[model samples]
Target: MSVAKIALVGCGPPSRRWHGPTLTELSKRGAIEFVALCDLDETLAAQCGEAYGVPHFTSVDEMLDRHPEIMAVDIVTGDPSHHVLAKAIAERGKHVMVEKPMAITLAGCDVIIDACQRNGVHFEVAENYFRMPKQRAVIDLIEKGILGDIVRVRYVDAKAQRPFEQTARIRGLTRPFSKFGNSSGMCMDMGSHRLSQLRLFAQSEPIQISATVKRYRHSDEFISEDWAHATIEFESGAVGLYETSRLGESLAHYQITGTQGGICDHQWSHPAIPLRLQMGEEWKDVPIEFERHKVDGVDVLSRIVVHTDPQIVYVNPFREYAIDDWCVGHAAEIMSLADAALNKKEPEYGLGGRKDVEMAMAIYESSLNGSMPVKLPIAETTSYERILHEDYEARFGRPIDAK
Candidate 1:
């Protein structure tokens, strides 16, 4: 293939922040050709494509027809439209790379997966977090036996407010709904990354999820959340404690504890301890290129990795770009995908993305059912959105979408 031709579908914030820059970088590397762009909004498609000197279209069908040489379409549409847009491209026998969380519902994910299978095309999701250089190194330590018999993992992601909280506020809603406009709410929105991290480190299929997802204090809704927390039981006899929110104080902490060793994120350890690993007989900092930059004496390394264990760390792609959390894993994701596309390789993120959505759904299910434990593969006739809609009607005496 002479530089696999690719089209980008959906020009949203994420598309601009991560996808566009990464794809452009790949094009510069001569790994792929930016053939065309498509979007429901002509203005968005035109602006995005013109910026790259590529053709633009308002419809996927039109773009596909015009660019018959296109080898892949990267779909970054909203959660609700993910299944529809991806299935459309897959049915045309083109490989697809979808943005994270896969879909708003399991059925939607199933449809996209089945479509790709029937059409004989590759299907992958843009799951970036677990792909980070530091994160990958940490996971390797756990997976290799350095961690020694995994026991449990703890992860917390709390954002005081969400992108959509203000939009919901403007609507005069008595309660906050997702700004992502998905029925899965922030649980799936942010929960996708949390669960992916847990699954990656724990290396287990979840057996059960016990948790709660609530919307409280409509007036103070930041990004949108009262609170969300879950405890997951893994099939491998391991456990994970997970929490996330778009309300109240920004904090993130993650750690994987095992019989012999442990690794944690910056937030999980003490100030005296390095953010990487302070393990073994003596707590020495992991040997990283190791530079810390801060504002007002507070540590903030735009994006630096500690070479805690050189054997596990490989050459990181994010460093070449502006290294920060925003650009880190995302650049790695596209870089790996570009290589995979050129080599005719399927990606590692396909089934895992769908499972991430499923695990998030399980967390929401537990919350909806009075904080009881919900078993995996949740055999419920109820969809996650149905519960949210019911709650909305009860709170406002009308359906959630009522205007």
Candidate 2:
């Protein structure tokens, strides 16, 4: 197999904790030629480069110019930088892999798509939740008719206020929710991942959405919503309820109810707590077995087996590397970009990332219009999107789509 020569951008916390080590491990295992690291912050780039044992730079242009062999670039930056950086990278004739919400607004996403199409480069969005081993097993079970006809998919994150409170205190609740920040809001941040999972679990397209987004605790300075509730109507007649709050009661509930059976879990993707299936009158635990081996003094997941009828197993393609279950998602993401760049094939989740962003935008649009149901494919730019664009221009002194 041909290894992709890739460079990474953004040396922030996510890069240090996840992307840096994951890329290092993959490179050590001969998966990819991890070329270099870049960030606007020279100190951060240098720190990550030293830790990962790679050259570092503060400019994307300089990095690409210096390492012309790098075929794809992994962008782990904030939501606001996604479109700008992706467009620039694609224009330079390199494939792009950007962290998700693909872009903060549909127009921004369109900018990226247009740039990549014009430049003849492919791009993949780093939405990794549904790519995990356990999630893959769950999806496989659903596809195999273990859960006949998914009827409802629900995700509720109640009372997760402590982390949000700490963030507010550190960043100062008085800090304005700006366009250049790491997060757009609750709905666009974690909501993007949950929305993507909901659609995948139902195996259907969302047709309409009704939602209410509000800020109960934070002051006006925090323009983003702290609480959001969205009801999605899927094309396959499946219903999806997504309720999350940075301030509220504490509970994590994720479930998929089908005609024949149901799957329930307290947390979203906890492999430790075996998934419960309700085929009969009572709920039974679906046994999960984790296969692991030592790699470079680290216990990496070799594969995960879900003991369902006939058995559902997800073998780690990168088991030879030191990748834990969580990093498995990240590894899959990088490999997706590599496949697209080297094989001249579409990504596993190519345009699906845009759909995820559209879903979140629909929820916000519905809330902006008094919880009115907003139809899918959005048709045009939303008022909420206009607000975001205006905010971007105000903060950066240029339009979001400015070259």
Candidate 3:
């Protein structure tokens, strides 16, 4: 098979650490022919392009005009730039792979997805949590029915100084990008991962959602919400309680209880040991190894399943190819998108990113609405709760998110 030609936009922190390493690994393995690196910052673009032995351009339009051979693009730009760049690429009849939260708003996501469909181009969202080998194992156990009917799902991710730094990333208060105009901040950015994990594990559509967004007092003027506590009720009648940052010490834990038994994992973000599984009254400490796999001389991390038991399965991002601490499964996710565009294999998240954004947006809507449970198929286009924006404007005497 001929190597697929790929291009990258945004040579910032995320691309440099998360997506860039994976794309480089793909080029090394001959799975992709990375054509060019594009960014608004000419210096950064040239630096990244030179590192990979590829050409770099400050403008995406100039690069595209010069290289018609580029078959796909990975948009690593900020939330505001996603729709614009994706639309431009889709217009040229090329597949697009965008970072999560797809776009800041449901309307933006709609436009991007619609354009991809209109242009007959593959549009894939980069969401890596559920793709992690350990998380995939939980999915397999749930599917095998050994865990019986899922009764309740509880997940927590707490951290100290989270609101401080993450808000910087969202409001563009830091380097790489600035003031992204995402007023929802941590509740939407990191909250999306929590919701996606719940949604994937439930294997059912969210029927109702209610949340309490921790306030700006815990954060600075840069962001509005510091954390989020959300509950989602699935169509399968299962409940998910997701407790995010609470302005405290760093901590992460997950547990799923079913009719028969339960399981828990302390290390959900990165590779760790002692993934406890229960089928009876006692806990079974099942050892899980994080490693790479091959299918007939082909590196197929997406196809390789981690066996949780005699009949249970899971998948972790390959450790052999990881470039960053948080990006263990990034390359695997990238490869999945490549398959969707080049090999006719559908991406697991395909367009579900729109739904993820919708759900994340709903959390803010719920919090400002007295934590009233918002149902799925949310009708709002703007991301944050209207009340929160009103509060911010009243406090600062100016509109924070004037996008």
Candidate 4:
């Protein structure tokens, strides 16, 4: 079988968290060649290249010059440099998989997306929460009428701050390209994941978003928010309350309430809440089990079963191993890209769609603007174009139009 040749930019900790493991699995499956690795830290880049047995470069141009056959670039770089690297990849006619929070500012994201679109290059946002096996199951259940009508949703992401902070410091100091615009903070950082998940699970774009952030902890270099909370009103009138914090000891929870039943994931387990149905005035839980299966050669025990009843139940078990939750979606993202590359099909969430960028930018704007409700229009083309002009003016001291 012929494997696709790919390049990976920004070999930071996130690479370790998801991309590294996935690449290892992909290489073993003969799905990818990992053509080159690039990072600002030459030592670290060399170390990682040595460990992974792939070529390393301190500059993207050098890497591309060495391997022009690279089909796709996995951009694991931080926000600030995302636009430049992604634009470069797209200019080369290679597919790009960018990390979430898309770009630091709403404007930079627009330019990046526009360049990719004009070049007919594939761009994919690495928003992995929506791809978790169990999360997919819940979405399926909701679609299949097991949940009846979803009324409300609550999501919590509380995690240890040490790793996040330390990693951020390392990458920020070593990689100038990783910096985003000064107007961004944590809401634009981690909140993108939660908001993306909400949109995916609800199967609808939020009509209005109201959010706020608090920096209870002190960090001198970064003025970013460390905690964020928001209310998203979806088109279906299903309201979702979401919160994310970098200070919590270990509180990762989510719940969604519906007319017929609700689901919750308080224990950090997949199939977090496999199936639930309204039994009388009270909600009854329907248990679904799974058998063992190999996910990328790693043993994953997942169950997909349906419980037939006056209330039909469908369950899809989540996969588990040593990697982070994001890996679950990474698999889907790669497969989608492969299909698009090999089969001449457009992959899901091609490049940076207006809707995805709107979803991400709205959360940042809503949070920074005192949780003001921001309405999303059916067409957000103006939003993207305006942001691009604004960013250009800020940097160049003149409108891009003036030039």
Q: What is candidate 2's CA lDDT for residue 239?
A: 98
- The TM-score leader among the candidates is 2
Model 3 backbone overlap count: 10
lDDT of 4 by residue, 301-379 (tens): 4555545354333322235443334465776676566655555567676533345556656655565455678787534
Q: What lDDT, from 0 to 1, does candidate 3 have?
A: 0.70
Q: What tens digits encode model 2's per-residue C-alpha lDDT throughout 1-403?
A: 7789989999888888888899898888888889999999988888888999999999999999999999999999999999999999999999999998899889989989999999999999999888887788788878888778999999987644654454343221122256468888887888998999999999999999999887655455556777788999999999999998876456677889888777777865666534666755877777889888988787777878878788878888877877887888989999999888888788888799999999999988888788899999899998878887888988888898887
lDDT of each: 0.70, 0.85, 0.70, 0.65
lDDT of 1 by residue, 1-403 (tens): 5777788888989888778776776676565677788888988888998887788899889888888888888888877667777888888888888887887667667778889889878788888878755566567667777667778988888754544454333221122343435434566777788899899889888999988776654553243445778899999899999987565566687878777656666463222223334365654445544344544343433434444444544444444343454455666666555555667677778888888988987776666667778888666534555654565467547543332
Worst 10 residues of 4 by lDDT: 169-178
Spell out the clash pairs found in candidate 3: 132-315, 132-316, 133-315, 133-316, 136-314, 137-313, 137-314, 171-179, 172-178, 172-179
Q: What is the lDDT of residue 400 in candidate 1?
A: 35
Q: Which one wins by lDDT: 1 or 4? A: 1
Q: By summed lDDT, which 10 consecutive residues of candidate 2 come out lowest? A: 167-176
Which of 1 and 3 is the better model by TM-score? Answer: 3
Error of 1 at 79 (Å): 0.7
Q: Write candidate 3's Cα lDDT for 190-223 as tens digits.
A: 7667778788777778888898765534233444
